[model samples]
Target: MTIKYPAGGMVSKDVQPVDDDSVELTLRDHPLIRRYGRLAYLVIHGEPVPAGRPRFTRQGHAFDPKRSRDYKKLVSEAAALQYHSELLHGIPLKVDVKVYRHVQSSISKVERAKRLSGKHRPIVKPDASNYLKLIEDALTGIVWEDDNLITDVSCSKYYSDDPRIEVTVTETGAKRPNNLKEPHY
Candidate 1:
């Protein structure tokens, strides 16, 4: 934590000498582990899929073939990237997700559009919420102890020539200085 003061504030330049062991000067209120922050990120290229709709068989077996395949691919991509990043255990996190969908061909029918064309901002399907489900499921065992630990999430969908999904995960309450129990003295 940094403190900023206006000119002529009460901070004094001199420190008066006191009896040894008579006083304690504490700069931080919490352990340095509170400040240790880590960011785990990955970008999956190709068409993104929503959490698959479940299909039940006559034998009462349920499955989501399409979404299962998609999550498999997504998880592999995330695992490859997350292998080098720190795994967050029971820590509240902030998840930022961005989905870029392939531009549809129907926009061509509309004519005489300025710089604010479909490419800059395109209307697409497969709700952002669906993407969240798939992503959260895929990342469960790899990045965190459980999906319930996520305290916050932000996600959006967009149009792009190269379809992809980018996920950025941050440990929200973690502080800096990796060694938590080390004595400052």
Candidate 2:
């Protein structure tokens, strides 16, 4: 806490000595005491925390505190501004969820492999735990208004337009001329 004085007002140059047994002064009566002494005394013993601070503009500018006439509103606005920086980085936002089918290893096939190998050959196989995976993406068009942040989550695969050259075709690929034999009855 800092102490300030009027432009022309004179303040004591020397500090006063306290009694040997004096306890350190605390602000139990006045949580904050940087205001006029008359009002401060009225609130020192039984006053609620005063509501007096400057409002912040939407563009992040704070108006001169001395010019603010509504002390309570000023204080409230300042409180909102004080925490704005932290909020933007960790805002708890709702993201649009997109779910689609992905080729997962058939669980039955994995079980058969494991049983045949007596759990020693390869119990944990690639594509063994084939199941639906949910892809979550954050939509940046909205601002988060909640207090908690979404740091940890479950995920699968995300859809994007990036091009890639896969060497081998998947099992569901379209039938080709050489592989077009009909199933025998």
Candidate 3:
């Protein structure tokens, strides 16, 4: 039987009878799997939107503002396109995200050139952590089982004419080493 991938294309599944009462279905080689192996790299084109502070009503109910919700939706949709059928579960993951914002139009040509050339990066708010937070929340359940499974995270921001967010998730085999010395105090 053929199963369709959400993004596009079709993958053929082989069915084998395990017993008289049951059968096992196995997926053949998928394009995404062959190309990226176990790692998932996604790029969302457009301006990066940082997660905003939660808004509270008079009754003390907290809610996300429209902009934050919209950005999260955008991220979720983008992630869905590259999602694999099996979810990454019970394994430590490492996530790397790079957020690129367009350079200010009011800036001088030289400044814009510098920004585009990476000589000057975006050091202004909202902070890089805010962008990372939004991405992590949006990718929950889509890319992996949960964001908490991510043991290593790296985030960066840059200025560019073409604004976009790039995310890379990979399974980290073996636990990271702890090199911290005992406290003397």
Candidate 4:
């Protein structure tokens, strides 16, 4: 799915396109996260290395502690800057939000089942499709504003107290012509 930002203004930015195929990749092998061995790379270090840096330098080369610290900070800011530019240009990101609640059990079937069946069969687990329905019921809506200047999303799940995750995306900082719209995700 593609979402464009700044739907009305002449200026817009194209942030990272959250793709179905790449979601797992982003969540698992994200370069920034993989580099530091923690998810806090962006949140703690600052910005990501330039897209071209990896091509030039070995991904696992060791650097001086001081140099590593400085470069790490630089990349974090770059990431934040890119996101802001995308917002100003009205760029949108594709995102999927899911909320889950654990189910409570009130039954003791192990002893009873074994006695009734005369053979101890493995326990059959209930499918999660039913839980997915609950999550679907919890989804409310997504909103984007001012041609992507600001995108706000709220849901029924947001109404209660749950640990919510907010993901802010920025454009790649590639400047377009004065009178052109960047490609949509």
Candidate 5:
């Protein structure tokens, strides 16, 4: 039998021949496969915006708030700069997102120093999950095929003078361990 590669290379092997006598392996050199097991990094240079609650109109239609939409667009643009084509699909992924919020100007110099030094973190509203939600939705179709493929995620928020969101994505090679214990019943 003959195996044909996408790069116009053919290799003859002593294997069972199918009816066609030629086998074409398409995914061997796919872009996603090439990027598998590697890390993808991106930074959105601005204040990190968390996913906002959906707004409903009197007509019973649901829509993302203007702020949320704008933030998602910004995130998508940032991700697009790093990845041009071939979104990852059907692969487990690990995502780490760090959100940096600007320190309040009203705080004292000592408090500002503490915030900038990472000694004082942001413990206010718009939790980490909300930030992750916006990032995941924005990255969909640009970084990966779907957000559900992300098997592991870590998110944190901090106060910084130069506010931004840093994202790192890696394709997990194998099934991740599920730490849930079986029910004793």
Candidate 6:
């Protein structure tokens, strides 16, 4: 006989979307704790490198002090940004991470307007998933004791004059917050 996995573990399986049934945590103002800026990156051979693989010199030894410092600072900020008294455990967590990044300055005025109007979507590097990974790792202990307590996650990227990440985390089976209108995120 085959055993069935639990249904609530996946966002795709969510019966009712976060709607009016979860707490909303917004962290756009806090710089270090809010979003990972696209401009902050590790450079090698004059090109910024993505996290995952280690960079090396001619001798094949790797060292990236700036990158290490950036990561640690981000994690520390994550811990500091969390709501101190909130009990974020036991229940399944549904998070919505909307990443706001700065648009390149080289684009023409018309193009910039289009971007600002949301008529044209910016397709660039520094993938959204990478930012989400950093957030998950950084918020592990402070947010919920462990990252495994998270049951659902929603992540997106957008262009903004002020770059930031708007994070909303909610626990299932909890009383809904009073001032919710739309379920859409």
Measured by lDDT, the strongest candidate is 5
Check candidate 5 and list the clashing pairs.
Answer: none
Query: Where is model 4 poorest over a 10-residue stretch in terms of lDDT?
Result: 41-50
TM-score of each: 0.61, 0.14, 0.76, 0.19, 0.74, 0.55
lDDT of 4 by residue, 26-137 (tens): 4326665456332221111111111111222366665434433343333333334323211223443322322222212343566444433435322233223322222222
By lDDT, rank the candidates, best first: 5, 3, 1, 6, 4, 2
Per-residue C-alpha lDDT of model 3 across residues 109-131, encoded as one tens digit per residue? 99999999999988888999999
> What lDDT tens digits, residue by residue, belong to model 5 across residues 25-126?
344354444666345677777678899999999999999998888889878876775554467788788999999998999999999999999999999998
Angstrom error at residue 128, model 3: 0.2
User: Which ranges of candidate 6 are over 4 A from the true structure?
Assistant: 1-65, 68-72, 78-82, 173-185
Q: Which tens-of-lDDT digit does each residue in 112-172 have in candidate 6?
A: 8888778876567677666666666656665656778777777776676655565666554
lDDT of candidates 1 onward, in order: 0.63, 0.25, 0.78, 0.29, 0.79, 0.53
- Candidate 2 lDDT at 27 equals 26
**Model 1, range 1-185, lDDT digits (tens) per residue?**
22112221121223343334423423122233235433566666567777767788999999777656556555555455434434567567888889877766565534314212553554445678878888887787777668898888999877666677888887665665686687778
* TM-score ranking, best first: 3, 5, 1, 6, 4, 2
How far in Å is the alpha carbon of 124 misplaced in model 1?
A: 4.4
RMSD of 5: 14.1
Say which prediction, candidate 2 or candidate 3, comes out ahead on lDDT.
Answer: 3
Question: What's the CA RMSD for each of the models?
Answer: 19.1, 29.4, 9.1, 22.4, 14.1, 17.2
